[model samples]
Structures are given as structure tokens and as C-alpha cells.
Target: MCKDKIAVVLVTFNRLDKLKQAVEYYEQQTYPIQEVVIVDNHSTDGTIQYLKEWVNGKGNFKRKTVLLNENCGGAGGFGAGMDEVLDEVRRHELDADWVAVADDDAFPRKNSFEKIIDYYKSLSDKEQEDISVLCSRVVNCGKTHINHRNRIKQSILRARFMAVPEEEYDKDAFDIDIFSYVGTFIKVNALQKVGTTNRDLFIYGDDQEHSLRLRKVGRMQCVPSSVYDHDRPGLGERKIGWHSYYDSRNHVYILKKYFPIQCLIMRCIKRYILDMSVFSSNTQQERKLFKTAYMDGIKGNLGKNSVYKPGFEITDRKD
Candidate 1:
């Protein structure tokens, strides 16, 4: 271990069991997490009480929890958690060299963090300084690579990014243009240089936006040795439902953030045409929501959970 303070920001909403599992995995990390900053998006599933118990339980780890007044989604949760770390650094209460963001359903192996830090330790000072984000290989439940690394399509007319195929993953550390937040360990200084995660995004595509913005700061690497299991279905395995709105809306905002309006419109058209079958499967209300997302997205209206909001009360499964 390099003795650099690392803060793991775990964001959760109504997933108490998965949250507990995530905390346990972090606790078991060989490199030892210096601090764990958990942002509860008003889980309302008895997660608060469980977190209280976990905090009070016997452990050598330093942990902090933030219960937001509202459900800010993953983007806002991470933004808030990182803001907490930055505030501590400002107040001279803590010195965080890196901040790792993880979801409630992601569980990193015990040596994953150690391997990530070891890679940094092996780097020369100049190399280390130029490195921005260190990402992990995300494998699905079936132990298959999830193609987490994203690269922007090299076209003037296209405003989208493409994921490298699983067969192409070489199982070695390599540079990438964008990465997801599931097991992303970002340098604190790099985050400071490129601003913070966009809280306005609320959820889907926020990681891509943040990672793309980080390209100006330093290089991003995906370390295959640092593996984590993301308990999520394969891409396109499930029909777009609750997240369709966010995904639909954020897709435009993200494209517009990176490309010109004309290119963005072109990409949107291509995507809309290709996804017509998926859209047709959606119910009337879902189609309406999708249309609203499309209209709001094209207009560059990136608001919070005002249009469609999830439950924030203390309900186990009433949502």
C-alpha cells in the first residue's frame, strides 16, 4: 500500500442487501480503504438503520454516511459524496489522494484495490501525475467481460461512443476514452482539475460525461487485474423501463455536451430509428415518458427528478 488515503463512495437506493454486500467487499480489500463515504439516496428500505448498525459494528475501517433529503440518483450521490471528500480536504480534516466510486450492486475482489494502487506505485512520478482515472474490469454474473470501456466514434456526423467488443478485451491494462463509475478509482487532483461529476445528470450516462470530461486532464486506464462483479443484466437483456427516461434524456445531453448540434441530431436520428422496435414494445405511458425524454433531451433540458421521481419514503418494496 502506498499510504495514500482513498475514499470509496458507495451510492445506494432501496437496495439494502446489495449495499451491505458492497460494504463487506470494500472492508475486505487488501489495500485497505482509508475512508468509505456512502451516499444514501433516501433508500427508505431500512438501509439507514442497517448502515447505523454497520457503522457501530466492530471494524477498523473509517466510514461516513450521508442521508440526502432527496433521491439524487447515482450521479448526484457521487457528486455529493465527492463533495464531502473535497470539503474535508478543504477543512484540513482529511487528505484524500483518490476517490473510488462504486454502486450498491458492484463488489470488487479483495485484491482489486491493491492491484490498482500497485499499478500506480509502479508508475514513474511523471506517469502517475498524468494518470487521471483507473478503472476496473467489470464482469457480469456469468463471468463474461461487460465491455465497460467506451471510445467515442471517430466521425463528424456521429455524436456517440462505442464499446469495444468482449472478444477484443486483451485482459491487460490499456488506455480508454471513457469508463463507467461501477469500479472507477479516480485521482483526486484529476477530479479537481476537471470539475466534479454532473449532479444535474441524476443518473444514466453521467459516468460517460464525467469520464469524457476527464480526457483533458490525463490518461485513463482499465486494469484487467482489478476485477469487480457488476450484478447487472447483460446489455439489452431487459427492456427499457424505469431507466428509459433517464437513458433517453441523458443520451442527448451527453451528445450535445461533446458534439455539435448537427452531429447530435444525426446521432439521435440514427439511434431513434434503430430503437423503434424497443420503443414500440413500451406501454403507452412509457412511450409518453420516452417522448418527453426525447423532447427534453433535444432541448438540452437536463433537470433533476422533477419530471419522473422514484419513491423516497421508508418503503421496502412499495415503489
Candidate 2:
């Protein structure tokens, strides 16, 4: 028997197709889920209306689509959705033993939930209780194969994108030292003890901050047996325009909030050196964008109204 009733909280902005596919994958999970909550980030593209219609047609799942009046970035949307879930769990109104946080663009494997549940059962009671945050191996969505070695190399590079090396990627359970919000399964009790995601982050680094806090309370693990296909397309080429701005500014916020002064100093130095090397090989436009992002990183300027943009809409339904 499944000891935990899972609540899958998905946050989406304008990705309607991806969201629908992700929900379809969720419906196929072997392990039972209590509910699926779709927190709409005020998308203007009729996403809310679509979800409303979809949820209306599906009566088997206790699905909820929350429409935020404003478009809070991913960080704020997730925190708010988590707050709602935790409140319901606390009141015993919702039978949620675990809160699974996933991106709308990702799809879990058919046996992903079963694998996670089995791993949970295998652990000692103490270990089970202590394991608050659990993550699954994420593979490229479009690609059918998993590149374990490349993932390991990416992790070692400490590149802006966090990825596990292909060789280190195992299809088994293991403890994780870092916290990843995307496609992570969190214990309800552990989340309550550690607190929710920081809304101040407003965009990036929020997961890392929350994970750091979770480590203090219980164990975090990467379950290789539980895998999900991340729907992000392969990086055929680099597009470093607005992305550079956010990436640079987010790192600064992370360092300021979590890292010690010396550590932050060393990080900045390393990043500067790396940025210079990267820019040396890139086009003029790419170099310019990277330079802008790097400067913004130093100034800690995340941009104006980065939390929400205009033309965004909110809805109460899944459509």
C-alpha cells in the first residue's frame, strides 16, 4: 500500500502544449496521486481557459487550477501554490503525504512514481522519515536515451546549468547534497519543518535556497531509478540575449543570500574568468550580451518588473 498521498504542484506560464503533455504523463503514473494542482502564472494565451475545460472533463483526478490575479514569476507561483497545498495538508483536508514539484514542460516515466515509492519503502523508518526531498534522474525530453557521463561532466563544470555526469548517473537511489526544485518530490512534514520556497527570489535561485534549508532538517536524495524526461529542447546553438541578463543577476542574488563573503569573492573571480573565456570564442552579439549579464551580476540589477510582465492573464480553470 502507498503510505503517502502525493500532490503534484505544477507551475506554468505560457507553455500550454507542454503542460497538457505533462498532465497526461501524470495520469499514467503507477502510484496513486491525491491531486494535481496547476498554478497558472497569469498566462494571456488562453491557458487558464483550456485547463478549466480539461479539468471539467476529467473527474477521476482531484485537480485544481489556481488563477493568480497577477503574473508572479515561477518562484512566487510555486511558493503560493505550495502554501495552499501545505495549508490543506495541515488542516487534514487534503491527504497529501508528499508534495511533488514539477515543471509543466516535463514528463515522468511510466514507472517513475512506483520506483520512488519502492525506494521509500526500502529505507529504514528513520531514514525514510529523514528523507525530506527526493529528486529523480532527468533526461532530455525529446531524446530517448540518458547521457550519464555528460551529466557528470556538466556537474563537475559547475556550469550555469546544473546537470549530473552521465557516468555518475545511476538508475538507483542515492543521497543528494544539493536541493533541486524542478521535478523534486518533497515530504510534507519535512517541508513544514524547513519552510517554503523564498518568494523574495522572484525568479531563480529560490530552489537552491529552499534546498539548503531542507538539508538542515532531513536528507535529500537523487533516485536514479525514478526518472523523468525534461522537455527542454537540445541546445543546438546559444541564444544569449535576455537569458544572459537573468542568469547573471540570479547568481548574484544567490551568492548574496547564501554564500559567505570569501566564497562569494572567489565565485565572482571564477565566473569573470570563465565569462571572459566564453566571450573570446563567441560572436559580437553574444559577447555583448554576456558582458551585459556579467556587469548586471556585479551590480546586482535583476531588471525592472522582472517578477511579472504585461499582457499576462490569470484564470481559475485549466484551459
Among these predicted structures, which one has the highest TM-score? 1
Q: Which prediction has the highest lDDT against the true structure?
A: 1
Error of 2 at 319 (Å): 45
lDDT of 2 by residue, 33-114 (tens): 8888898989888898998897777644688878888766777888988988998888877988889887787788888888
Per-prediction TM-score: 0.87, 0.79
Candidate 2, superposed: residue stretches over 4 Å from native: 141-163, 236-239, 270-319
